[model samples]
Target: MAIRVYEEQGIFHLQSKGTSYIMQIVNGYPAHVYWGKQLAFEEQPHSFVDLPEGPLFLLDRLPQEYPQYGTGDFRSPAYQVRLGDGSRITELVYSAYRILKGKPQLEGLPAVYCETENEGETLELELRDAYSGLIVTLSYSVFEDSAAIARSVRIDNQGEQPLQLLRALSASIDMPRSDLDAVYLAGTWNREAHVQRRPLGPGGTTIESRRGASGHLLNPFLALAAPDADEDHGDVFGFSFVYSGNFFISAEVEPFRTTRVGIGINPFDFSWQLAPGEAFQTPEAVLVYSSAGFGEMSRTYHRLYRTRLCRGVHRDRVRPILVNNWEATYFSFTEEKIEDIAKAGAELGIELFVLDDGWFGRREDDHSSLGDWTPNPSKLPGGLTNLAKRVNDLGVQFGLWFEPEMISPDSDLYRSHPDWCLHVEGRRRTEFRWQLILDYSRQDVRDYIYDNLSEIFSTVPISYVKWDMNRNMTEIGSATAGPEQQAEIAHRYMLGLYELLERLTTRFPNILFESCASGGGRFDPGMLYYMPQTWTSDDTDAVERVKIQYGTSFVYPVSAMGAHVSAVPNHQVGRVTSLQMRGDVAMSGNFGYEMDLTRFSDEEKDLAKAQIKRYKEIRSLVQQGDMYRLVSPFAGHEAAWMFVSEDRSEALAYYFKVLAEPNAPQRKLRLKGLDPDKLYKVEESGLVMRGDRLMAIGIGIPAELKDYYSYSVRLKIID
Candidate 1:
């Protein structure tokens, strides 16, 4: 990574492994010059300010690095502030700049990091509003091995009086042309991360989440791709906000055909009271550019996130093949029943047994006992310690689930602290799943939770924890906050959560944490920083999962997805699929099972045993290897993908057909990411084929297969 500057011409050029970003100072303002394929630094880079146009027209047309409101730019501004005199218009001019050898951490927020300072470089540009004494610093960090640039903004109030910020975005960019289509992920509840693409309109196309979460309805990810971009060929630019709270991303096309894209915290119902000498830092935004297509773009993110973004011991280790009891016995399982399932799972080579919900308080259902963390003596007979030891004695590790962020009205904790939840006086507090959101913004609330959880972790031999949030925020008012600080509740809540997680994760470094917002609702980069993995979705049916998991791969790596094989008739969609298909889909991610193993028939038991054993043999490759997409499930009824080891010595390919066709012609599956000069042997067919021929000519599909049929082939290098 390198940051080049031409002091005389006021040009800054940042170069990553395969891309470049250049900006220039024009009339005391930072003007965006180019951002694409790498180019040598030139003292006289092309300038938009030098175009032949009127003074007003030039200001409107020039590509700005960080545009401001009321600055003659019609497009959306990166930030907006109100002064003490009630004036909103402000213009910031470039004042100074500093370059650093490494990236700086965002205060109280999660961001991507490098292991060594030499792995990346950062450039900070300071702009100042002399009249108002407002300083905005734009930061850009480029990595040595990845083609991704991390961007964020820091606002400092240097005047004597307080200032209110109406909008503070993380990053913005202006593309030279408006010839790309918007590609994003959108869905809801049981269905999450469904890929959607559309052409850019004349005005702005915005996607946001106001639910105080990176909602299940819209993910904080946006990609602008060429009109004809496919999996393997075309230019694609991706913008992912590294935040788990409410956020907005927009793509606006101007009259001159230039597209301006902006992403950051949702500016609706959001404001920050910046006191003098105080600073506000926006969350980081990751920008990726890929000229080879969407597939390459995804691979770049996978490698970076798996190595640098996710921390802890589990970051490099293969995830455990565990079984959760949520689907087996939801809120109604006894101690004896759990032990029986644990024994059966141990017999089938399962590594961990997760006892989910109903083990605490008088919590027979979701309506009560959320905030109370004490285990129920009636179900366990011998406390959590005895139950956990019994499960461990059965040859499987123990895991537990908790919804610490929710408070049920009928619980003891709520009764004791009546004002602990988010609420507005005389207004109704909306409850989803019969639980209210805890006001995490308060220090007392966080301390209560931290102390309680610390006690449990220290006492129990828990090897894993499933952190879940079952609902969104409503009536987002903090009881302890004054009127001036009321609007900061949402942002403050996120900050509090980060602090809590940091403390817990550090205290218990050995325990693996998996985050879940009712499954896939809060699955963003911010959560991934604390918890390495996330439950992919609530719907576990193999057929539905094919599409769900496929869409999720657009930005997330396989190691970060928690996939499990559930019962035959799926709980969410009631779709019955074959065990083979379910196992095949689940093996692509952190492999596991969520159904009752004791209830399995003799044949099913044998099949599951074989599946677990096979997964153990290739788990490392699937979890750590590079992935290639051969066919898209969104475009047709068939889906195919493959994982190749970093050394190109081992490969695993899977193909699935949702519905079978009668009298269908023969077809071959093409493979990707292979060495063309090497020869390989296919384990399934027991035949040898050249790598080039196998990838070029492909392999044939089984002739007589039924509905929901799936196939997998393992390839190993042959001398």
Candidate 2:
């Protein structure tokens, strides 16, 4: 068994493929012991319960694995409780624990699951607040060949009166002082998920997304690493949440010199009422330990999320080369024009044609008809089916864009059901993108969206759906929920969205779904559970994308990144980069084009055709291989990255020079992640070279390349 428990020693050890996690109970309270490189130390029964004098007498000094409130610990609590009598203190004690043969499913939440009984095992630590009669069960699961420990909590209200839950986090970990530095993914809308590393000093650093999306500003990922650790070496501890709502992940240093990491729902505007016989389950948070450094940690995450966390028909399948019509034509086009673009794309080897917004509900711009789902006859004269058929006739798959969670004030749906939006009495409705967020917390609203989308899916032959949300929540009040439960709206909103997605994806299992929120605002693991890919950024400028993709690669794999080549003097950054550079950077991810094919010159069309043909050659390696960052764009003028196949027989490297310094010396690029003893033949030049020399002595780059220029080389094992 991967999971083992020793009652005599009160120790629980969870052993994954390459890592070990140890926890112990001291006087009915759990404390984290060790989590790092796997150790062979057996658990020998030893007594640590004898109360020591002075500062050690205080519970705060001990490394608690799951600390509670009101126990005089004075530190952050894993779960906070309030009683009917208005007491906010919780005195929790460990009651019992069960080691199960298989993992139990979390109710109303998405979590990683064991595919079979033999794949993994689970453990549940049951704790009780004696005075309040509140039972909290912490669930942990360890897989057979994975290093991720899935952690979550279940709070069952067994008392006579109702209880208020203020801070119910998914997981909290305690660590002894190792002089660790914290690393997290942070950025705003068009520039999301940039890696930021800093010292975990006296004060705490909190990365949260209260924007109701696991917002683009701060993704739900955090890491605590030793100060000397870099990308390829040292120990690193990673924590990531699987929920797509308002979340908080923090790394704080206590006065006692121990660092406590916490992750779960943001309690700022969150409160859940647990009635008698009811239970509340926090979203699952994954904890990974890598004594081999961040790259190994990333590979572990990439493996787990890509294979287990994500689901559906397209999970492991190659993503089609789709060209979205949003940047191509925005809100202006007709059925004939769409067919023309589809024809052009099909002629250029594009596999899918995605008809973006303004194809439905009398919509001309972002101002109107968001919730209406009917096809606009004026734009699509033959309706969706006819257009889809026309596009399919051209040998290209049909895709579409939809913003179902939004309702425009000028829309017919809002005109009929004004109470459907999220607004309180006597307040002017707030609007972003000229639309109001439909209160998904209302079952009727969710049913409306699900039914309408189901109808569209049943009628249209679409192979892809670009699901998008343009803005954050504004009013926060749901008309269907009770007044006392106002704080639950935000979380319920997320659950409702998940419910909708679950229904749609399960119903239409063959269709591929891509999540987008103003080009990556809602990009998080929670969304990845349902949608395999997310639009990496709205900024497609190759120069800006280098940094954007770089920061995102620290956590997300290239398979999850949606990159596209847009019109030059790029739509978002307005910097003109060569077609070669743009295509090279975009090909590092799920490659596609987001520009008009109707306007391209014969030469430009040839370039795009060549780019598409070339990408198809290395698509699998780029999508599924182990990635290595050779040079840091965060600290240098040149950006370089490499990907090696799982078997280490093939590799692809991309080198970009952002700026040309006057009289700059020729750069020698050293490749990584290749088998050192094997010889590789460069496909471009048919030149054979040893991998050791390629990495140690390096390859001489061309000096004729100037700024905004890029080069890519593919290498295969020759002998």
Candidate 3:
């Protein structure tokens, strides 16, 4: 059993493969005991600070499993609520708990799941406020195969009167020590998910996104590592929120040197009204502990999320080598031109060809026709059915792009139902990319989108869908919602989006849906539950992607990232990189091309064809293998990573140099995650070496490598 309870001692110990999280009920309050490397079960007195009496109670020093506001604890709390009497003071006492055989799903929310009953165990602790019939249930799930604990909270309004929830976070835990560095991912627009780290200080350190979506500014993830922690050594703790809306992850160091970590909905411009018998379920928060290092932590997340969090037919399948027309033609292309590109992509062995924007309602550019799902007769003569067959006839599957959550002012949907957008009544509606966000918080709006999309999906031969949200929310008010429920718009929008996706993906199980928010804006686990992959970034420059993709791998698997090679003098970044470098970088992920294949020279075409063929041969290995990031792009001018098959039968290593140095010394790249005793043969050089020597002694890198130079070396077991 992953979860063990000591009822006599009022203690609960949850164990994963490599770690244990222990908590105890102290004076009717659930307090955190210890969380670290796995320990043998033993009955012993827990070490705790003696609480001082009266007003100066040492509640702040007590490590709490779910701390609340208005208590003696001065640190950030896990939850806050407003009672009917208009007071925010509330304290919860332990009521009851249950140790279940399997995990329970969060109502109307996405979370990590257990395929079978034996894969995981769940513990639910019920705490209640005696004064007001309010109940808070903190649920924890421990998996048998991964070092991760999934936590969530369910608040039930048992009282007769209504109450407003001022703040509600998913999970919180207090660590005994505070000597660690806070590692977070931060970036904006074209550059997303850059690794940033800083030492933990006495005060609170927070990374959040209040831009409606998870925003490109900050990811819903945070990690605390020992000062000396690196890729291969020391201890690290990672927290990832399984949500897609505005969220905040915070770490606060109290005066006694104890650190409390919390993550969930941002609680900024956010509130929820719970009526009698109503309940609110916060999104799940995943906690991962790594005594081995950040690399092991990443692999734990990769394996768990890849298999448990992501669902549907595509979850275990290799992503198609696609060619998206967004960067190639933008909004300017006709039926004939599109077919030409598809023909060219088919010749280069691309499996899927996507027709991007401008294939809708009088659409010419980004300025118009967003919510219009129908194909534009001007660009696509016979609509999507005709265009899909044209591309499908060229021996390539057809894909499409849709910004369903957005509507342009000139679009027919907006003109017919002007109040369907998210805007304050009588206030100027904010327009981004010449479009306004649809009020998905309403059922009618979701129904309209579902109806339209279902029609198209049923009629066309579409094999893939790129669901894009180009802009974040502004003037986030729903015309149909009451004033008291206005604060629930953002969260409700997310729930509605999830509901829509569930319906669409369930109806069209075969279509591969890739989520995008201008790029990596809405790249989060919540979306990943519905869509298997996401466009990693709009910036496809090979040099830039080195950092973007590397940073993303901290919490996301390579299979969940949609990376593609674009044209030279890259559309997002004007840096010209070699075709080899671009292909090498893109091939490291769900490989694809976003360039004009029809314009490629004969030599370029031949190179692309070879790249496609190579990707086909190694796609499964790359998608399903364990990844080892040898060198970080942020730390030096070179970046390298390797992938080893789970069975230890095959491996691939890639090395990239951004710029050449004059007379640089020879360097050897040490590999990881390989069978040390196995003899492996390098396919490229026809050289054989023992895996132990290859990893310990390493392989030589090109000493004369130039700027933007890269290479991928494949290894297989010797006969």
What TM-score does each of the candidates earn? 0.99, 0.97, 0.99
Per-residue alpha-carbon lDDT of candidate 3 for residues 85-158, written as tens digits (9 for 90 to 100): 89998899999999887789888899999989899999999999988789999999999899999999999999
Q: How many residue pairs clash in all the candidates, one count each?
A: 0, 1, 0
Candidate 3 structure lDDT: 0.91
The ten-residue window of minimal lDDT in model 1 covers 47-56
Per-residue lDDT tens digits for candidate 2, residues 563-630, read: 99999878887888899899999999999999889999999999999999988888899998989888
Candidate 2 deviation (Cα RMSD): 1.6
Q: What's the residue-level lDDT of 562 in candidate 2?
A: 95
C-alpha RMSD for every candidate: 1.2, 1.6, 1.2
Clashes by residue pair, model 3 = none
lDDT of 1 by residue, 114-137 (tens): 888999999999999998889999
Q: Candidate 2 — worst ten consecutive residues by lDDT sum?
A: 45-54
Error of 2 at 23 (Å): 0.8
